[model samples]
Target chain A: MAFEDKLSMILTIGILTSSALMLIGIAAILIQGGAAGHSIKSLIAANTTVNTRTLTLQDAFSGLSGITAIYLGIMVLASLPVLTVAALLTRYIGRKDNLFIAISATVLFDMLVAIFLIPYLLH
Target chain B: MLLLLLVAAGVLAGFIGAITGLGGGVVVVPFLALYLGVPIAYATGTSLISTIATSTGSARSYIKERIANMHIGVSLEIGTTLGAITGSLIAAEVYALHLQYIIYILFGLVLFGSSYFSIRKLKMKNFVPGKADWSTKLFRLNGSFIDEATKKKINYHGRRWLLGLAIMFIAGMLSGLLGIGSGVLKVLAMDSAMTLPIKVTTTTSDFMIGVTAATSSGIYWERGFLQPLLIAPVVLGVLVGARLGSKYLVKLNSRVVRYLFIVVLIVLGSQMLLRGLGVF
Candidate 1:
């Protein structure tokens, strides 16, 4: 199969899995009355500020044990693109396409800085 | 009830975005921030997540249909990713300074600008193939895809690659800054600068947005903006709605989509501007 076909398959599966996880999270929240004791009312409240500052990664991961579905879903959604880029870079390397490899590397570096370096610098 | 409302909103956004070939972040941002009273920062972050879902949702068919140009998309990412990093830095500064109103004003301006271009684009006919420039040869910016509607294989090459990259850089910055896919600007860069077909422009823009969003979303996450609860319903709804929307896209007349886009842009643009100016 062509590269595009592989990519499409990966994207389709990634999206389906993430969406399913998100839906399950919603169901759990609704039925359980909220994630980890926070009521659904407060979680979705119009005036709420439930951001990363308030909800740590540790908290989110802990909630992954059937307490909250959304956090894991989001983790999957966010990481899929990074993984796709990595795959593209690997393909370019196999073909020895320096130009594309460089471009892909640049994109990965940018992502890394945005995800890790910048946040660390800000502190 | 709130989850249901979010899902409903996401579905509408995804439907309109996919059908119009505009992408959903534009609609999601304004709807969440303006209509639903979410903070602008949180709204943008949430919309960024939705963009990834919509892109992934429609990507399968786009790839199968072969309307998208991966070479062009990957090459353009060089500019976009760098721009996204810059844009996110700016966003961090703006939020820290509590000058998010400036971003609102910029978003409004961009929306109005894109609407103008969308109308202008409507008057234009199909692409008249142009000569490939030096950059095109260097970058290998050429490909052919079958036009599903015409049932003919359309062969084409791209020119003005550097120009396209420059425009894509700005588009990337806007994507990161606003937490949108910024497909309008990406399409504009390709459609106007690269002289690609509108179909190619839209599909290729769709192809590129996911990586761009991911790059910035990482920053949004680090900045403590990725609110999981808010994102769940929006992501799921948009993925499903966009899938349904893509099925109907080929059947709709271009003129109808253009008109709908103009109307939406006008209303959302003005609302964002008014809210930014403290008039709302």
Candidate 2:
């Protein structure tokens, strides 16, 4: 398959998976009337104290609660572009296209630093 | 009830954005901040996350159609990602200092500026590619795409990579600062500066925005701006609405729609500006 086709497939699968997880989260919230001990009303409030900074990945994966599912869904969505760039890097490396490999590597490194390193440093 | 309202707002923003080509962030940020009374930081953060949805959705098709120049998009991303990092940090500082009014004013200005360009672009003629410079050869900034309207293979090459890169950096900064895709500026860099074919420019812009937005959204996420309840509904609604709008775009009298949306942009921009000025 062509590179574009592979990319298209990855995006399709990634979006579908994320959307499904989010919907499942909404459903769980509605059915349970809350998530992680917070009421739905509180969770939906603009000034709600629950957010990424207060929640850990381990907490999100501890159970399939509404908030946790939504958190995981968002994590998946945010990682889609990184996954695409990684795929591109792998392809370029296979072809020994050093220039594109360097470019892709730089972009991937930037994303990783922003997602992981900066947050770690700031906190 | 709030969730439903948020979803409706997302749908409207995404639908308007797709049909007018102004992008969903333009609509999402203003409506959330001004109407829904969400904090500016949270509003922009939500818009940024939803932008990833629309970008990825559209870019998938563009890539398959082979109109998007991956070579150009990937190379320019170096500048955009770096700019996004700087912009996100600036936004963090601004929010921390309780100067959200700055973001409101800047977003309003961007809306006004992009509206003007949208109208001007309607009257612009096709680009005539100039001589390839050194940056073009070094970056391999050239590609060909089959035009659907003309059914002809149109070859195009980009020149002045440094200028394009510089503009892309600014575009990325605006994107992070305002939680927008800044597609208008990206188009400006590629269409006006790099002199690429419009098809190539637009598609590649779509392809690049996801990464640019992802860069900033990551930082926003860490800052606790990405509330799950707010983002989930908006992202889902935008993804669905953008898909519907793109399907109906050919049937709609887009010129009429564009003019209507331009009017909406002016109104929203002015409202945001006034709000920032404490007129409300």
Best by DockQ: 2
Please provide, for model 2 over B10-78, each residue's C-alpha lDDT reduced to its tens digit, 9 standing for 90 to 100: 887767655544557888888788878888888888888888887777777778878788889999999
Per-candidate iRMSD: 1.7, 1.1
- Score candidate 2 by lDDT: 0.82
lDDT of every model, 2 decimals: 0.80, 0.82
> Chain A: TM-score in each candidate?
0.88, 0.92
lDDT (tens digit, per residue) of candidate 2 on A8-116: 9999899999999999999999999998877888888877777777766676677769888888888888889898889889989999999999999999999899888
Task: Please give the lDDT score at residue B74 for candidate 1.
Answer: 83
- Tens digit of per-residue lDDT, candidate 1, span A64-117: 533346777887887777877787899999999998899888887887777778
Off by over 4 Å in 1: A63-68, B252-256
TM-score of each: 0.94, 0.93
Per-residue lDDT tens digits for candidate 1, residues B106-152, read: 98999999999988878876666678889788888778866656767
Model 2 DockQ reads 0.77
lDDT at residue A62 of model 1 (Cα atoms): 72
State the TM-score of the second chain for every model.
0.94, 0.89
